[model samples]
Target chain A: MTLSLDLSHRFQGFTLEAAFTAPPGVTALFGRSGSGKTTLVNAVAGLLRPDRLRLSVAGEVLADTTAGIWQPAHRRRIGYVFQDARLFPHLTVRQNLLYGRWFAPKSPEAAQDFDRIVALLGIGGLLQRRPGALSGGERQRVALGRAILSQPRILLMDEPLAALDEARKAEILPYLEQLRDELGLPILYVSHSMAEVARLATTVVLLEAGRVTAAGPVAVMLAQPEHAQSLGLREAGAVLQGQIAAQEEDGLTRISTEAGPLWLPRVAGEPGRPLRLRILAQDVMLALQAPQGLSALNHFESVVEAVHLGDGPGAMVRLRAGDAAVLARITARSAKAMGLRPGLRLHAVLKAVSVAQENIGRGA
Target chain B: MTLSLRVSAVATVVSLPLGIAVALALARGRFPGRQLLNGLVHLPLILPPVVTGYLLLLTFGRKGWVGQWLDQWFGLVFAFRWTGAALAAAIMAFPLMVRAIRLAIEAVDPKLEQAAATLGAGRFMVFLTVTLPLILPGILAGTILAFAKAMGEFGATITFVSNIPGQTQTLPSAIYAYMQVPGGDAQAARLVLVAIVIAMAALLLSEWISRAVARRIAGT
Candidate 1:
């Protein structure tokens, strides 16, 4: 399924003109604050009647202003998870989750399916409790459950985890990953957190001041140095799809990527389960030959896909390791000495990649 | 005392739906004559009780146009009757009820309504399930306030429906009648104490009910 939108909305002093198509996966609407991400989401949800709009989800026309077709918010059949959780305070957790189901048309999409969703979100214990009694993470889980039970054509999640603290965010992120993978539903996730975009997004739509600056797969969007300014320089990195090969006896976990198998500190996942490999550009190193290892494991043969030199002293080098793309941010002086160009074959080294913090996450 | 209670209870019950509707319109509706409607709803609150009663008499008295039409068609009369006292009390209490309900409606977050819409609830359904439930405390408070005001209504009831013993003479008018007589001090004092007790009980009852309601809504 694909969600497509063409909206032109004018605010008091700002104007937003955006048109994009989101594929059937987690497509992150990535931008900073006041970049019209929320406005666009609201427009899609029919909460805000944009100055002009033409939106369709999986070939179903939702709104086309020129054609005088307008579906009110209640009839849109799109679920939205707001930043504040917006759970009905007067209703219990179970009632809040079923609020939408009451009005949904009779089908699997709108089925009560109560016990399954409750167990999936781990909100079974909270069924009898009210929203006020739940923690931030628990409330978000219930909110997600509520949106899903509504049986929407597409889910619009506007910074669903933005209100939670970092610890709470970590607590709820795995549930979101489970939702993305298990639900098999398209989610248009709005966020400014590049790390979240890198972890959860299969596709990235970079927004800047109400316009789409770039939209592509996660690998290309992050590895593209031209987007470094919007996607923070330090946060820009390569996102790889990999599977767990084995758990090494030395407390290391081997992940099989398209490029080759890379070893990291013990990551908790069963063998053959998918894991996303997030390598910070600064973490990758380059070599002219297979150098003897100090602590590094294997080197993979790769070609220089693109070399970008900025005003700063650092230069970004995109490397093609088999079918996968890896980004290495090396010094401009080193690039000059190595004569790195678009097509030079070289060995891309991992240099014992650190698993500090959120460098690895569950696959979507 | 029974007459006063009957009048006040009838007045409050009769005015509730209108009070909520007017309050909603005043708080959220964007239309012509909104300011005029708001001012008209509040007229009884600001005007002297006697003035409001005189206006009601001109409109709803048996000899008045609407009152005459009702008498001829439905054989109903309000002038110098217990029903007229209820009418007076309801008018006097309208402003308080509208104000309380309006403030409650304003306190609700519009975001919750938006969430309900996305959940596939139409506008009326959203109001029934979300808006109405959330404003229960406010409604209770408003109703109690109106009831209390109606119970205490004196000047309007006396003006609109003359102080007729056993018919329109409410507790307040009855007390006034007692105080006008020489050596009626003891009876007047007892009735004043009774009035105080009733008012205090109503206030405490409303406080307790509203507290329980607020707690339930908050889920704490």
Candidate 2:
């Protein structure tokens, strides 16, 4: 399934003109606030009418202004998970989850059994509770499950995690990854956090001042020097898809990455499960020589692919570790001292504990 | 006092739905003459109570346009009768009820109603289930205020339909009748106290109900 949006909307001082085709995966609309991310998603959700909108999801035309075909939000079959998780206060969790089902078209062949959704969202324990009783993370999870139960062709999430604290965000992201891999649902996720985009998105659409700055696979787009500047050079990194190999006795979990095996502080998942881990550029260090003894647990031999210089003080070095690429944010002085350039071999060391636990997820 | 209470009850029951409609229209609907409609709704409030009664009498007298049609078709009468007094009180209190309701409806988050719409509720369904329930506290408050106003309505009722004992003699009209008669001060004073107590009690009751409902609906 694919979603396409060719829309132009003008709101106050902001003018948004963006056109992109998002493939069946998690496409992160990454940008700063007031950069038209929410506006673009709202247009797709039919919450806002653009000046010109020609949008389709899975070949279904939701809006075509030229043809005068505009489907109201309910008929669009596009589920939207709002940032606030606007659950009905009067309804129980069970009732809230089924709120959209009454509007969904009859599907004799594709019935979404309610029990399955309850279990999938892990709301079985709190089915009778009201939304006010649930924590922020739990409310968001229920919101997502409610959207999914309606059986949407595509889901539009407008910063679903923005309302949660760091712990709440960590609590919900695994389920999100599970939804992405398990359901095959095309998701349009809007967020300002580059870390979230790197961890969850297969495709990233970068927006700046309401225009498309870049759009492509997450790996290639994020590796670009221009993209790094927008995402902050310190936050730039590569996302590695790995699987849980085993849990070591020393409180470290080992994962098999494309580069080889990487051991990180213990993750709470079973062996052999897929995981997506983000190695932040700042957490990685480059060594001119293969160090004899280093306390850091992760070290991979990589050849310098490109060195990108920012305005002052720092440079971003891209390296190819086996078939995978990783980034390191090193100072200009260090880059010169280490004689770092394209085609130079170096060892990249990363502290096991410095990698945020939230960035570690189970990758297929 | 009892007659006035009955008149207030009947008028409130009759005009509650109309008040809600007018309020919603003012809060959400846009039309060519919306400002004119708004002004017209408040005319009874701004006019002298006697002038409003005179207008009601002109429009709804037995020989008047609407009164004539009603009498011919349905044997309905609002001319110099208890019903005419109720109508006068309703008109006089209509603006107060509508203002409260309109403010409440405006305070409702349109996004919540939109959320309900996207949940597969039709427009009417959304209003009935979501919008109406959320604004019910306001409706209750408005009804109580209008009822209190109607109970104390004397000028419009007496002008439209003379203060006939047990017929159109509401609380205020009864008090007025007592004041005009010889040796009737005590009776009028008793009725005045009853009216004040009822108004205070109704206000308190509405406040309690609104707070309880706001808690349940908004969960704040």
The numbered model that scores best in TM-score is 1
What's the lDDT for residue A264 in model 1?
82
Residues A1-364 of candidate 1: C-alpha lDDT, one tens digit per residue = 8999999999988999899999988999999999999999999999999999999999989999999999999999999999999999999998999999889987764444777788889998888888888888899899999999988888999999999999999888878877787777889999999878888888999999989999998888987877876888887788877778899999989888888888888888788777777887887889887767546775678999889999999899998988888888899999999999999999887754432222234223
Which lDDT tens digits does candidate 1 get at residues B125-177? Answer: 99999999888888889999999999889998999999998899898998999
Chain B TM-score, candidate 1? 0.97
**Which numbered prediction scores highest in DockQ against the true structure?**
1
Count backbone overlaps in model 2: 5
Docking class of 2: acceptable
Off by over 4 Å in 2: A106-112, A248-251, A268-271, A352-364, B1-3, B72-74, B218-220
Find the candidate with the highest lDDT and give its number: 1
Assess the local accuracy of residue B215 in candidate 2 as a C-alpha lDDT between 0 and 100: 68
Q: Residue A333's C-alpha lDDT in candidate 2?
A: 94
Across all models, the iRMS values in order are 0.9, 2.7
Question: Residue B71's C-alpha lDDT in candidate 2?
Answer: 93
